[model samples]
Target: MGGFKATLINEIEKLYKKKKIIVAAALALIFIIVGQLATIALRNGFGVRTVGSMEFPILVLSVVANTIIPLFAALITIDSFSGEFSQNTMKISLTRPVTRFKFFTAKLTAIILFVFLNLMFVMVFSVLAGLIFNSNTLTAYGIIRIFISYIVTIFPMIILVMMIIFFSNLINSGIGVFFLSIIVFLGFKVLGILFSDYSGIFFTSMLDWYNLWIMSVFPFIKILREFLLLCSYGIILFTGGFYLFDKKNF
Candidate 1:
């Protein structure tokens, strides 16, 4: 148990040491800045007319957050496995005291933790900016709703990240995983819209879980149901990604 914990900790340290993670963190900060700026601009321009001034800002920020954060998450994970093989680190890491399953799980766990933390940070910062710009406090219930929606939205996003991590091992080229992830993300999204009738299967479009919040408009049982399903979808994709990853060989 002690050894396993140590190994996990080391894996986490390794993840943070990467330049890609640094770049991703920097990009998330940009998201924060842009979200804050956009909110302020929208409120000033709209100023409570047909829509609440805060409405456009929040909506635009949410759109940006939902669309962009997943790409960050995927880029973070893209190199996790593939990087090991490409850099020839696999020979050392896999030959260590830890089992391959444990190594993979630790990496996956770290990736998920990073994605969740980053996602929460961006959402919280955006809301804080919204508060600053609009002077409209998101009530406790509103905060809770937003928090739930953010978490649900990020689940599918992380699945996309995990899938990219799984692919990283196959490609095993520097920056290849990141580029491939972006391409797949954009392509799948297009496919999802072009084939809207079967959009549910594609994890990328599942970010629309936010629509449920608007659908219920007041947090009812139906919204709760949809939230559960959305969360389940994330779990399924994440676990399936791992299952495939475990079978992958260098």
Candidate 2:
């Protein structure tokens, strides 16, 4: 147990050591800044009050959670699983005393941690942009809702990470896994739009599980159902990815 603890920490440390994560954050910040500027232009120039101050965070989250974060999650997963293999870091890490499951778990947790930190990074900036530029920073309730929205958003994104990890294990090359994920993601998106009635079954549709996606008043039952669905996907993907990881020749 203690060994696993150390491994998890070390794995997360390795993830943070990457320069790509830093660059990703910078890009996200730029997106948020641009969003704020656009929103300001619409309000002041066109008198089009489309978005308010309190709603900025939720708006930013909806855009990024589905696009930027998922894209980065795929990139991180590809780097973590495939890049390590190509670089032969996986072989060196496995040579340690840690078990396969422990190493996989640590890597998985670290990727999830990266997702969360990315959310926090975006959340903070979005909130500041809102409060500074947009009018009417509302009550504590609004803040709580923003916090919950961002927190709950972590689930679907984690499932996205797992899905990419499964791909990472099956494909030998990092670039192959990445391109395959993009193709599949686009395919799922198109399928969901075409088969709108059956959209719930599509992984891309599940990204809309964030509370404020469309609902003015979210139901507890609906939330629970989607939460369970995401959990099921996460379990299946993790198992399949781990199976491949365990059987890989290195």
Candidate 3:
């Protein structure tokens, strides 16, 4: 356990040295701020009704998910493995007195933690934006609902990160992982809808924020169930990524 902790610390240090966390944080801040600005515009400008209701929050969240969250997740994890391999540091990383599984898991854990923190920042900023745009007494339920809503908004992006990490190990380049992640996400949505005839309740349903918002469907129970399914998918992909990394000739 001590060894694993040491390895985790080392991986974190390496990440910091590369300014990966800093870059991710900066992007998160930018997205949150942009989301706030866009929300203000939507509420105040264009003669639209700025009623302090669930509709406003949902619209704002859709904007964030569609614009901000996707870019941040992609840039943060796009180079998950290729960055190491390209720099020829994979050899040094494997030389550490730690199991391959632990090393990969540590880095992935860091990225997920980063994503969660980014989500919190976005939620807080959105609330502040809400207050500034219109003076509504933020109710307890409102606060809780929007938080759940925004996190749920980013659920598909999180799954894409897992896919990126897994394929980053399989391919020789990070670009492949990045593009493949996008293709799988958007392509699956199209194919799932056009071919499989699957309903919007499935994981693919979450891919299109516009559809989710227009449907006016905030099925909390269903969202919770989908979140569990996403976590399960994440665990499976993470395990596969680890296995590939462990056996790869790197």
Candidate 3 regions exceeding 4 Å error are: 16-46, 51-58, 151-157, 192-204, 207-228
In candidate 2, what are the lDDT values of residues 122-176, reduced to their tens digit? 9989988888886476668778878888887888788888888899999898999
Model 2 pairs in collision: none
Candidate 2 TM-score to native: 0.95
Compose the digit string of candidate 3's lDDT tens values, residues 110-132. 66656666667766665666677
**Residue 159 lDDT in model 1?**
66
Better of 1 and 2 by TM-score: 2
Q: Rank the candidates by lDDT, best first.
A: 2, 3, 1
lDDT of each residue in 1-250, candidate 1, tens digit only: 6656777898889877877666766776676677566555665787623222234334643665555567666666756666566677776777678766677778777888777776676666666666766555546656666666667665666566666765675565748777777788888889998999877666666667665664445657755665566667656655666676667664
Q: In model 2, where do residues sit more than 4 Å from their true spots?
A: 212-216
TM-score for each model? 0.78, 0.95, 0.77
Cα deviation at 120, candidate 2, in Å, is 1.1
Question: Residue 104 of candidate 2: its Cα lDDT?
Answer: 94
